[model samples]
Target: MDHSIRLQIEEREAASLAPYATLSRETKGRFRPEEECPIRGAFQRDRDRIIHCKSFRRLKHKTQVFLAPTGDHYRTRLTHVLEVSQIARTISVALRLNGHLTEAIALGHDLGHTPFGHAGEAVLDELYPQGFRHYDQSLRVVNILEKKGEGLNLTVEVLDGIAKHSKGRREILPEDLSELPATMEGRVVRIADIIAYVNHDLDDAVRAGILSESQIPSHLQKLFGPTHSGRIGAMVHDLVVQTLKNGGEILAMTPNLLEGIAELRSFLYENVYETNRVHDDFIKAKKVLRELYEYFINKDDHWEKVIDYDETTPREQMVCDFIAGMTDRYALDLYTNIFLPKPWSVM
Candidate 1:
């Protein structure tokens, strides 16, 4: 069989996709260019690379919300990324944008997230001199940590989308366009990230018995809908309608939908994320990471155990990298090994 499938797909993209879509053929290309695959376009290739990388696989054991949740149904980082990819692709397809690029961005967006979710992030941000943000760490994962530091070598478009997907406690569609990802596909992932997390987090909170459905603000329930799927559907529909109405030049949501989402986020911050029960665990998780950070930095023997440690890299940065890459179970087990007394056994 002829192996010119990539070329054929590129031709189809140009013939069918929107004017503003980020086509695979038009990628800014990887930092270190290699021979193109015969069967995959650049963005599709990027998506595959991200999916197969070690860092992406670690996402399954990482926290999304509820710290080390015992419940089978709570969202892990992997599930959250999948949800974001699904929603982003739906929007991209509606807008006639490149779904592959959108899925690539979504899949790679949270590759750098820490164990115990944002709690671990807060601890790293305070301890590290330069401060830590998961988005930057995620970029570092692809650029320097994965594949024995050879890196994923993904396209610039994917990297840009991954780097800029984060919007911490800010408006979904900010007044500053510069803060957003460069491509329309990237913007789709950005919105989809928040949409996925907000609804899923709320659902998890209710499932965990932390918040009753009645506790959710009546106005938001009315504005979006009463159920999780209802809320997500409303937001996704609004986003597609507004973006299409604006001719796909910019990704957008209706003013009311944006306001509702912002309010819902604030409610979660106060009631779910920052409440006493959650905050207590967050504090304990911070201590675990902080002690691990100190132990690894001060003890060369401990540092040597790190799989990717390099003598040339700063000890502090190496510690941060190791800690950030850890899964929730790994972090907890390591903590127990380092700090907790083992059973007295003499064989």
Candidate 2:
């Protein structure tokens, strides 16, 4: 391949042309041939903006499985996003797709996840009678939360993919998927999300002593192969080969592959999520969150600093949002102080 084209293979085509892509499609401008390419430099800037955002940084303190402040090996949401980005970029490169776009989508995919993984999400969802979802919250983060007024103003493609990345099937419309700028790249990220979580969640479960390698059923082991690492390697390899062969179409894991992953998920749910080990912590989290919610709702002065909204906004949401944005240890400390009334003497 010529150096220009080889570089294209190495870097995402979109990154170079992101700035042009940001221009309205109807807008007219004269530029060099390369400037008018499908991918634009603005997309790269947008991805970079997301990476540097405070919310993105806070992902390091958020949970993937266990609550924050646990052991170091436990997967934080930030690490999980990086893993997904690695997997998606590998797939993108193997298939001669835009690695930058895929990686950008992967990194931004989980920006809306709550502080405590699914547990904190569940609490927020329950608190919202109208229903709350991380995907929407993620969009909110990029569109509103990043700055005081306008957001990073990312390209439509990145924004749209982040908004509908979750395959809820019901939440996304066909038009939404059709209108995406880099459909194949988005699909790579979508599948990568599942791939990263399933494999790593199992790894975390095993390390926490909630599951054993032998606990993986015999039938599953034979079909999907042994151990979490082995399964992840096989799955990623299989997907890469199949995607390259099939022109970048996402290759859904076979029934056996699906079953194996499900078994692992089920084991974690039963052994880790449902057990008293988790519930004990959850009970405390619930109490602390509720108390903090009540505290912030009643106090207008403190709410002003944490939120952009006026005092008229409901306290429950403000408190939840503030708590949701906190790093793991910060939330825990806040909870302890408010509900347990811990005294902190200021120097």
Candidate 3:
């Protein structure tokens, strides 16, 4: 079949996208080279691959901030990534950067997040000899874990974006750009992650009755706004406006807004993330994950059926992959089956 439409789209990208935008035609290529699609550009193809992957499906069941929150409105990992994608796309589109690459990176950024969120990750980091990081695990998911160890073979731009999307509690924007991702789309995802979580997590905290709207620092509300949509709108507007004013050479936001975001993050840490309501559940999650890890590592009679990534891989790494791959419900169910006593019943 003729593939001229793909070339036409590429030409359109070149004419319309900014000079710094990562053009789909100029992609750095995937880990394993393959023929190009007739309709989709490289980044678009990568986005499709991520969306169709098993890990992507599991995200709906994984934790974002709240651990197995009973409320329906809590942000699971799936919704968190979608929010990040939306914010990132808005920024990328405004800057004339590659929205496709930004979207692909944003969607795949949290694929490696643990079942119970950071609590599960913390447990693995302590118990595993090599330590654990969700970002690296995200790369591992796209690089080795997905497709029965064949990997997604995503483009270099997308891979770079996923690998560096996280900043933890560190600086939101460092003076050195090298510390950030290689492409502008990747950088957009990085900042968008912060934007998505701080706002949504705070919203969730309010919903969970852990924090009231009035309790949030007044300055944050004034700067970002009192409502969730207003807060996101203000932040996105600042990012686009500041970056455009700086000629789009670098992503920039007014120091006041940046500082405001940081302060809001700090408040969440002190009042929401570290508070007893959240931490108490995390404590229990930690126990369940720890015991499950030890059991699987030591007892190998039937784990392969569930975690058969590769027969050659070391059991420890395989177990780590399995645990990282589990959804909150799956992990809980497995724990209950393995550790809890069942009453005898009629046969």
TM-score of each: 0.97, 0.79, 0.98
lDDT of each: 0.91, 0.66, 0.92
Prediction-by-prediction clash tally: 0, 8, 0
Residue 102 lDDT, candidate 3, scale 0-100: 94
Candidate maximizing lDDT: 3
TM-score of 2: 0.79
Runs in model 1 lying further than 4 Å from the true structure: 1-3, 302-310
Which segments of model 2 are wrong by more than 4 Å?
1-40, 167-182, 304-307, 310-317, 342-347
Residue 340, model 2: Cα distance from true site in angstroms: 2.8
lDDT tens readout by residue for model 2, 1-347 = 23454345325443443322222232222121224234334445456778988889989988787776468798899999999898888766766565556766778877877777767777777775555688777876776666763555666667666876776322211335454334566777777777787778777877888778887667767766777667778777877765456544444444555556566556666777778876677766666555665677677573443348665766566666676677667777776766676578999
Best-first order by TM-score: 3, 1, 2
Global lDDT of model 1: 0.91
Question: Candidate 3 on 103-145: residue-level lDDT in tens?
Answer: 9999999988899999999999998789999999999999988
RMSD, one per candidate, in order: 1.5, 6.2, 1.1
lDDT of 1 by residue, 142-167 (tens): 99888887888999999999999999
Better lDDT candidate (1, 2): 1
Which candidate number maximizes TM-score?
A: 3
